[model samples]
Structure formats: structure tokens, C-alpha cells
Target: MRRQDRRVHTYLLTLFFEVLISYIFNQLFYCETSKAALTSMPYQCQELILYGSVFADNLQDLERRLTGLCDPGSTEFHEHDLSFSLRTGTDPDVTIRLRRRFNVDSFTSHQWQFRYIGGPEPDQKCPVIVRKVIDSIAYSHLMMDFVKTLGLRMDYEYIAKGTVWTNGRMKVVISQIQRTEKAGHYDQSNLKRFADSYLVEISACLPDSAEYSATAKQLRDFADQLLPLVEMEKVDYWRK
Candidate 1:
């Protein structure tokens, strides 16, 4: 009887450990997949990391720095999104600084931006066409490495459009930014702000009744539904 009891105890212990291992593996896998889903963008960078090793830390910061739609750079200018620039390595030796993430809160007023490498243009309003957008922005900055990196998606379009308010009326227009192809010998490029967006300013032209209110609602709805993945990083990893 003593021998049988010891045997059962050993078996139970082994089973418990096996179950615990299984649970741990499952949790790890779940966390990984969740992280990937949260990032929502491609994991590979010129095939450097195959969407593996994407973790809750550092990864979130990367996501915000890479794709965060809240344009914080433009104070004299307001911003809606960011672009990346790439530098390629061909010789036997080279080093490049890839954008990891930005301090969202710390960035406060000071702005940082990334641009496209080179390629096509983003389809109007189809923000998901990130390949083209990133490519365009990178090329504007003459970045080569960014062109090699694939699987980019821009799901949001936040523009601080210009608006004029006159006679209790408002008119909205697409905002324009001042930028040049000049590389930095001194400082970075400029990212202008859309202090005024069309929807926000357009209602000024309408009568001061609910008619303009509907247009305002339309703009707000468009902002919420039409644009996705604009700001997913709720926490800034660098701070943590």
C-alpha cells in the first residue's frame, strides 16, 4: 500500500508539472500574438526580425514612433502622422540608426519625424496604402534602407487643415507643409501643423443652427471611423 501511494504521488506531481508547463507556454504564445496584433504593422525590417520577438515593451514604443498618427512635431506647425527615412549599407562596414520609438510625453512640444524612402504615393484617403506613403516620404529624404523594408501600412490621415472664420462662417481647406529635399547639415526638416481642418472650419459658412451641427458630426464621424490605427500606443514604453 505504501509503494502504491508513493507511485500515485509521483505520477500526480509529474502531471501537475506538465500541466503547468503547458499553461506557461500557452500564455507566452498568447502574449506574443497579442503583441503582434496590437502592433498591427509588419514585424520585419528589411527581413531583420521576422515579426518574432515583438514584445509588450520596446515594441509599443517602436509602434508609436513608427506609426503614431498624433503629429507632435509641428508646434508652429501641427502634425497628424510621421514618415521614415532610411540609409542603406552596402560596403563591408556601415552603421545606421533605425527609428525605434519616441518619448510621447517627453516629445511634448519638441517634434521628431520619419519619412518615406521612395516609391509610389498613398491613394487619396486610403490610408492603408502605407507602402506608397512611407516610400514617398523616405525618398523625399533620400532614404534607401526604408525602401527595402516592406509591409508598411498607414491607416490614418490626420491633417491640421487650414480654416478661415469670417462673419460667423468657416471654410476649411487642406493644409500644406513647407519642405525641401535638402539633407541635414544642420537641422531636420519641417512638419507643419493643420491648425485648422476642413470639417472643423467648414461649418462657419453654414447658418448658426443644427444644419452646421450635422456637418460637424459628419467630420467627427469620419475622423473616428474612416481612420483606424491612428493611435494605438496608450503607454509610452520609454517612460517605463
Candidate 2:
């Protein structure tokens, strides 16, 4: 059998190399952000971020697509998550602010926590709170319903800071929206179309297939339900 000291060194080296390769490949083999959509979404926008990837394009079109899911005919695209700024004491939190198109009740503001923080339970999903804003519409824009998918994937093989750490680089789909004469927005040519996918991509890194299956379901459901709204039109959706 191999000596005990050599065995320990070999094991450590294997782990270190695994993690290093993961980071290098992630940086070098990233997706190209050139997807286009002819149809314009309501409100002028840009992708500041998508999911957890480095994508920071297609904000206007992405917002347009997101709001089209629930109340298709309304001018307000509500109940979605887009990158926005927040502040706790002095720390500026650049977060995806979940907004409701209109409020029904007098008090509907709610709470949310950053999911990327290295806490006790990084795998445990955070609780989505209620975001209520009063308006003619009855739906409360709390708890963003779905996520948009633009067919691009970010691949990685290792964790950034070992097992106790995570990453934030993303594959983004940048797009722009323009209003049409038909009372909505449509891409005249390459209006705006996108596909974004992101993950840590660790082999044998999970609880089980059952857990993985559940997570996959959630992601697919979100993508299927939200992306088509890219053709919507509402000047107010992109604004504060």
C-alpha cells in the first residue's frame, strides 16, 4: 500500500486541482451574449443581471417578457424579479427587486433576502415575501412567479472558494424593446431574443436524483411561463 503521508498529499492535490480547473474553465469557456429579439418589450431596459450569471443585458425586453405572463392585456408588467438597488443601513444591495404591477390593498410591501450570501444554509431557498402596491389591478406583485430563459449555459467544474463558497458569474441575454403601432411592441427585425443558463456544474455534487429532479422542474416551469412576454408593451413597466 502507498505510504500514509503520500496518500494525504495526493488527496489534497486532487481536490485543489479540481477546484482550480473549475474556475479557469468557467472564465474561459463562457457564453457569447448576442441573442436578438425583433419584438420590443414594454419600457426601455437593459439586463443588469440574469439569475446568478454575469449577464447584464436585455433588461427592457426581459422585463417586458416577464410581465406578460399573468395579465397579458395590462400595461403594467408586475410580479417579477429584475435587478434593482437596495440599502440596509449603509451597505448598498444591488438586488433583483421583485415588483407588483398594481396594488389592491392599502398595505402590500413585503420582505426578501439575498440568495447568494454565504450563510448557514446556502442550499435552503429563501422565503419570498409579499409586495403589495395599491392600484386598480387585483393581483399583488409579491413573490416573483417565473424566470426567463435565453438558451445559453454557463459551465463550471469546481467551487470558487472550496465547499464553503459559491460564485456569481452568469450567462446573460441582452435585448431592447420598441413600441409598435398595433398598441403593443414587436421586434421589427431582431427585436430581442435571449437564452441564459447558469450553474456550478459539479459532478456527484448533490443530495440525490429526487432533489435534482425537483429543482429541474422548478427551473423549467419558470422558463416556459415567462419568456414569451418579450412582445408586450407598457411604458410604465420599465420605470419606477
Candidate 2 wrongly placed segments (more than 4 Å): 1-14, 17-59, 67-210, 228-240
Evaluate model 1: give its lDDT.
Answer: 0.27
Query: For model 2, how many clashes?
Result: 39
Report the number of backbone clashes for model 1: 21
Q: Which candidate number maximizes lDDT?
A: 1
TM of each candidate vs. truth: 0.18, 0.19
Off by over 4 Å in 1: 1-147, 151-176, 184-217, 220-240
What is each predicted model's overall lDDT from 0 to 1? 0.27, 0.25
Q: Write model 2 residue lDDT over 100-131, tens digit each, in one string.
A: 32222322443222111100122223211111
Model 2 — TM-score against the truth? Answer: 0.19
Top TM-score hit: 2
